[model samples]
Target: MTLKSVIFDVDGTLADTEKEGHLWAFNRAFQLWNLPFRWGVPLYRELLNISGGKERLAYYLAQHPEYHPLSNDEIREIYRLKTNLFMERVRAGVVALRPGVRSLIGQCYQEGIPVGIATTTNYDNVETLLLRHFGVQWKHMFPVVVAGDEVPIKKPDPAVYVRCLEQLGVSASEAIAVEDSAVGLKAATGARISTIVTMNTWTYHHTFLGALAILTSLGTTQTPAYGTGPDGWGRYRVTVDQLRAWLV
Candidate 1:
């Protein structure tokens, strides 16, 4: 299909902001509050499966109540602190978009294909990155940014995708979703939009049953497959050349 638009997830898909930036911000907040709690990378990654920062903290509290001693309201306050710290880090230019993301976004613009960001991350966080990276007129570059807290449900629910389509004025069939995680794939699939799975650090090993194609990167023309599996059953690693051939 000649795609009309491409929607992306934020953290793992369009950027690598999670590992260092996100983790650091949360840790900073923990220290400031003198909370006897901290997250390992593994725990952080697992918590990411939860939607929002506040929600993640809530999940952690639920997982191990003996850890934080903070109530829901307290957790929310801590999240606000973390968000502020995250914004400070962002201002320091520590957080950034991932490899090929800026280039691919420019390419999509040149190709006249609408691009969007549909994420469970905060809107201000997305705006901060876009504003800092793309500068004054960044809003004109891309208009659709569907954030997690904006809707009643987050990823694996499809509310954001549905809202993004409405905002972009495109049908589900007119665009494609690119994502990095299995949870993300479920969200896109629930929206009934075709999805391309890009293997992130931790998601590559999980099943991507509904993905239209799975690629190492959004490289060049590669013929991708539908209904790929846990193994490489219906899937193959793609290259720029292969993508072109597979597009038909």
Candidate 2:
């Protein structure tokens, strides 16, 4: 495979957005709605096993029927509020690209290797986060962005990854997916794309069985990544050249 493209998952792979970004936003929205409960870190971690935010909320509610029985419309309303809050958090600069993320993405852009995003998050969240970090021309930097609502289903189903690969004009064998959790790994690999797993606080315990590489972070010159992979190219940092060499 020539490694024609690099597809990234937004939430944890690009930035650690679960704890402070999405979770906080969800909790804040719940508070505003005067919902009886809030999603603490531990419970949120388990809820993350569910894919999309709306689906996660629905699953949580279904699991605990004792809470106020909100109709589907009410659930959507809560998620809408949460989404807005998440975008606000992004605009406020609460999140940052993970170590080596900008460097790697820059390398891909400069090298003319197409980079895309396949995420179960909404498009607004994606736009807000990337726009804040990459500026207004972020869309040019990441041309193929397949959000959760765009596809028929979320991660573990491969719909998002399939759509991303289609838009990027690359076959699964010619692209690599960078993801943070087992759900994402399955989605990428399910599409026959080789994947790299970058663990975060919420997903550190996930068993990434099919990932080509598993690392703590992408690694920086100051903060080197720690994990096992197919080659030594990721010894210091996961560079584009390293990915190319490893893929060969």
Candidate 3:
């Protein structure tokens, strides 16, 4: 299989957005809404199993029946608030592209390999994050961005990845997906695309049974990724050439 493109999952895969950025934003939204409940790190970890911000909130409500049930509109409002807060954090430089992410994206661009985004996060969130890191021309750099709003279903399902593959004009075998959780791995592999799982503090314990490789992080020359990989793979960094070699 030849790697003609690289598809990235946002949220945790591109950056460590769960614990600090997302969790904080959710809690802040709850506070502003005067909700009696707050999602702690541990509680949010359980909710992370559910993809999409609104879905996570709905799941949390389902798990705890004591809280007042919010209508669909209310849930959307909450998600909107949380997204705004998250974007503010991004503007404040609270989140960043993960180690080696920018370099790897640059490598793909330089090599003429199309880079795409397949995420269960809202387009606004993706837009804001990339604007801060990739500047105003982020969309030009990433030609295909299939965000949560674009898909009826989210991760753990193949819809987003399938749509992304469609837009990229590539078959599953021609693209490699970079993900950070079991749900993402399931989504990518379900699309029949090989995926690499990168571990973060929130998702390191989750199973990534079908991933092509599971690394601690993308890693830089100074901070090498620590994880399991195919033979001849290196941890010092995950470059475009290395990804292509893995496909070979």
TM-score of each: 0.86, 0.97, 0.97
Ranking by TM-score: 2, 3, 1
**Candidate 3 residue lDDT tens string, 1-248:** 67889999999999878877999999999999999998888888778899889989988898889989999999999999999999999999989789989999999998889999999998889989999999988888899999988988888899999999999999998999999999999999999999998889889889999888999888888888878777535665889888988886
Q: Model-by-model lDDT, in order?
A: 0.76, 0.91, 0.90
Higher-TM-score candidate of 1 and 2: 2
Clashes of each: 10, 0, 0
Candidate 2 TM-score over all chains jointly: 0.97
Whose TM-score is greatest here? 2
User: On lDDT, who's better, 1 or 3?
Assistant: 3
User: How does candidate 3 score on lDDT?
Assistant: 0.90
